[model samples]
Target: MLYDLIILGGGAAGIFAAINAKLTHPTANVLLLEKNAVLLTKVRISGGGRCNVTHACFEPKQLIKNYPRGEKELLGPFHVFGPADTIKWFESKGVLFKTEADGRIFPQTDQSETIIQALLQEAHGLAVLIKLTEHIEILENHASYFTLRTKKEIYQTTNLLLATGSSRQGYQWAEQLGHTIQKPVPSLFTFNVPASSLKHLSGVSIHPVRLQILGTKLFQEGPILITHFGFSGPAILKLSAWGSKYLHEQNYQTRLMINWVALSKEETFVKLQEAKTHFPHKTLLQKNLFDLPKNLWKTFLEILGISYKKRLIEISLQQLKNLAQKLTGDRYQVEGKTTHKQEFVTCGGVTLKEVDFKTMQSKICPRLFFAGEILDIDGITGGFNFQNAWTTGYIAGKSSL
Candidate 1:
């Protein structure tokens, strides 16, 4: 069967594209192909199953900044269909999304299934054909139509949208079509600090802590989690995102400096001195001057070789200075990295320059479109990445006709 529009992925971008394409060209037949049996696997597990649909940021210019790779390219698409459009689109589909304090938007039910069901229902209602476990073995683009061959079937489409995000097969298909692909690498990962003092303090969370990748200007401040493997949290994830390319070049081995107390050295020392003077009889560990978790404070004290039972008054000037220094800048070697939960993202994909953002169509191939992580565009954690999916998918789907 010859389809008017064939989306080569069933992820967020593919599904969104298929729906929009069907809507824009009501008589056009849209088919969505997925290598996996399931559709929207990432959406099912996103945001801890809450499914971050889009970021709360509505401004188009500001929304483009979250993307590290395709910031400039996305600026054009985002202006056309940004976060506000995403919210409206989903809401119109009967899925009410709410934004969190951190600006991540999710359904009011707090279940990823809501978003998945909405997408599935919308696609089904629009008569968008969905075929699962259908892998494209070969793609042949002719002057009039593109032929996609699988083991058992030959499908042809006039408009082909490659929304296959980060899949190796997707890259292979783009390469076959004369598109340059960037080497894919891990992004939004957590550093594995084996000998970190916080290693034993698993389940302890600290907020407003600053993390800096040693030897680089990469820095982020937010909540941090001390896991058994190492550190995982918003701050570390953000740093991992910005430093993904550089750190990948470094072989995942780098030094990380942590500021348990997000305060200047002078300010930290003043607070410590005040604690010593005001609570002379209280033990340094018992006083908890930094508003840090009790276990974390004890771990730092142990690292500093200070007795937790020792009274603050008994601490000498040298020990006080050491504590302050450690609090402001504790360094650890990140020996490796771990996937930051199920929300793993790749930093590289199809080179962005080949695709026209205004229409999301390929410059090399007419009637060929691109969207989602398949492009070299990827955003940081939160809902920025999904917003990329919506913006590009909408443009590709609408303009493909």
Candidate 2:
């Protein structure tokens, strides 16, 4: 039987779109296909399984800032169905959400299953047919309807939605249907500094650190975690995301400048001078000034060639200035990148200009819709990526009907 709507992929956007499409037209025949055995895998593992459903940022203008690629394109969509709408939609389905201090919204139970169950239940209630482990091999548009041929069977639908994240097959199908595919690149990854002196402090986390790509205007400020592999944390992830394309162009070989104290060299110098005067008799190692972790400070001292046994008062003016510069403008060479845990986000997909954000319908092909990371839209860590899924899915589903 020819379906009214067929959503490719059982991810967040595809499943959500299937439910919304059924909700839009109660008797419409909708089918969702997934190559994987389970649906919503990403949702199940998001935010360390708590499932960051959406961010707390409510305003459309402010919410778009989180996305490095779809900032301007998402403005209209977010205004239509933003974080507030996501909260209400899930809450109405019996899932309670709580916003953390970092503005990430998660289920009160802190289990991603809560979210998966809600989406599954809604789809089941709406009679949305779901086929798992089914991969479509060919897609042919017949003007009025689309034909999708799987290895085992063939199906047809009047409207097809491609919510296939960053899959290569998804790009192929989109290209077959006449959409321009942007070259996908890794985003939201950690920098790999194999030769870093701070490698020993694997678990050391510093807050309010400023990270910058040495020769570029790209920079981010937040907490950074020193990993055995390299640097991974909010600031590094943000920087990686914003500079994904550039870093990819550079082959991930670039210089990363960091301000550990998030302060100017001059400010750090003054603070150092104050510490010297206040603790004149104490050894530089004894005071542990500047609020940096004791072990990290010691390592810094070692790297700077300053003796820990040296009294603060005995240090010369040049030595103080050197310490200040090191504290505020440390540089490290980034040799590669590591995926941020299980969350691998990409920086490219279908060109944004080719998709209508209002309806998420493809400008090149009628009745063809796109959503999620499959589009050239990605946001930094938080609920922003999922929010994009929900917003675009809702629009596509509603418009498909």
Candidate 3:
């Protein structure tokens, strides 16, 4: 059967495109194809199962800033259907969304299944045909219709929307269709410091710490979480997203300068001196002057070779200087990168310059469109990535019809 539009992939962007396409043009025959038996796998696993739907940033101007790669390309798309539109779209479909303090938006039910079911129900209501486990191995774009050949069958469509995300198959399709793939790389990952001093402090979190990639201007300041492997959290993920290309070129080996105190060198020194003066008899481990975690403070003292039992008054001037310097700026070597749970995002895809953001249609292929991670658009951690999916999906679907 010839379909009016065929959407590749059953992920967030594909599903959204199917629903919206059927919504705007109910008479059009739409088919969604996916290799996986289950649809919305990433959405189901996102936000640790809560499904971070989108961010709370309603303004398109501010929302675009979170994306390092497609900031300029997504401006027009976000202006048309930003986070607010995503919230309203889901809510109108009976799924209520709530925003957290960090600006991540999730279903009030806090279950990814809610989102999955809503999209599925909408697609069903719109009569969007879905075929699972149908991996298209070859796509032939004809002058009038596109031919999609899977292992088992061949389907034809007049219009096609490729939302295959970062899958190699998707990149191959884009390349075959005369588009350039930007060499996919991992984004929003955590730094892997195998021999990090803070490895022992797994599960410890430091707030408002400044992190700078040594030798580069890339930096981020936020809460940093110490894991068994190394560091993860807002700051590390932000830095990872912003420096993904640089780190990729360096073979994922780099050094980081962390400011645990988040203060100037002079301020850190003065603060340490003031603490020593006010609590002369107190041991170095007795108080966490920098408000750092108790265990982390103890670890720092031990690393400085300062005896935990050493009274503040007993600390020599040289030791004080060492403590202040370490507190303000400590260097750690990052040996590798690790994927963050449920937050894995790709840093590259089909070059954005080849697509028209106004309708998410490809300039190279008139009847073809792109959306989601399939484009060279990725955002930092939180709900920004999903928002990109919704924005592009909506436009691609609406305009494809």
Worst 10 residues of 2 by lDDT: 338-347
CA shift at 238, candidate 1, in angstroms? 0.7
Candidate 3: lDDT of 239?
A: 97
lDDT of each: 0.89, 0.92, 0.91
Model 2, CA-based lDDT: 0.92
- For model 1, the stretches where C-alpha displacement exceeds 4 angstroms are 340-342
Model 2: lDDT of residue 80:
91
lDDT of 2 at 247: 99
Top TM-score hit: 2
RMSD of each: 1.5, 1.1, 1.3
Top-lDDT structure, candidate number:
2
Tens-digit per-residue lDDT, 1-401, candidate 1: 88998999999999999989988998998888999999998999998888989988887778877877888888778889998888888888898977789998889999999999988998899899999999888899999899999997999998899999989999988899889999999899988988876777888899999999988899999999999989998889889888999999999999999998999988999988999899999998788888998877887888889999999999987898999999998999999999945579999988888888899999988888998989987788899999889889999999998
Which window of 10 residues has the lowest lDDT sum in candidate 3? Answer: 339-348
Ranking by TM-score: 2, 3, 1
**Better-scoring candidate (lDDT), 2 or 3:** 2
Q: What is the alpha-carbon lDDT for the whole of candidate 1?
A: 0.89
